[model samples]
Target: MEGVFDLERVATFVAGYQSVMSLESAHLADTARRLWWKRMTDFWQLEFHYDRNDDSCDELYIADEALLHWWTERLDVVERTFAGSAQVPNSP
Candidate 1:
């Protein structure tokens, strides 16, 4: 489901998933790295917009590109969050 980025929601979702099956926190950290790498290496969105002469996915491309920057900047915090080592604000 697509929605605004919320770290707390992400943590909750991960915790929920862990309830069903065991997942190593280290795995989450590794997955974050892999995702970042994939984002860094991918240009499909740009290809679609520029090469394919399509604008339908422009907004998505922009959002994802921005997200890549955001994620890169907060990579450490993200890894910590995934590993349950960072403190997330308590939900009200």
Candidate 2:
């Protein structure tokens, strides 16, 4: 069966988003640095789980506070980056 989203791809997207935004300001750069580690931890902690009944590994059944906050912050950076780019491709 296929998953709804690819965790690795999500992680890569988040990293790329952070890298692009880090160029704007020192504070944003720090946030992006922290976010990279947070994303890695949150991905493994919240995205991977074990099924008790089946005794097998599985994707998470639900999202949690940490993951929610992580994604929200990630989206915020991505939005800001997109909004700021007037003509440039904004590649990072």
Candidate 3:
């Protein structure tokens, strides 16, 4: 998650492809899949600072939007689940 938002191909991937099952839409609000996107975004191009373990390094061609969308999916799923859940009866 360091130095992200610089630029990546994920946005183009999502915009070009609209398939929900595909990687493009796998992290969309509908599917609620984030494990993949998170993995990608969290990746850093440590090639330059691998030895030093510097976090202020550039991302490995990651998209900040991709991460944002991916994270939002979790909230979206949670909200939907709670919104549709039936009220639980209180047992005194």
RMSD of each: 3.3, 11.1, 12.0
> Ten consecutive residues with minimal summed lDDT in candidate 3?
83-92
TM-score of each: 0.80, 0.28, 0.22
Candidate 1's residue-wise lDDT over 1-92, tens digit each? Answer: 23224678777778788789888889898988898899789988789888999878877876787777767777877776776556765432
Q: 1 or 2: which has the higher lDDT?
A: 1
Clashing pairs in 2: none
Residues 31-73, model 3: lDDT tens digits = 4334434554564455546756665655534554455554454
Ranking by TM-score: 1, 2, 3
lDDT of 3 at 52: 67
State which candidate has the highest lDDT.
1
lDDT accuracy of residue 27 in candidate 3: 35
- Regarding TM-score, does 2 or 3 come out ahead? 2
| CA deviation > 4 Å runs, candidate 3 | 1-31, 35-37, 46-48, 51-70, 77-92
For model 2, the stretches where C-alpha displacement exceeds 4 angstroms are 1-24, 44-48, 51-92
- Which runs of model 1 end up more than 4 angstroms from their true locations? 1-4, 89-92
lDDT of 2 by residue, 1-92 (tens): 12122344444555577677654544554564566557545534333343234423333423434454544555545433333332222222
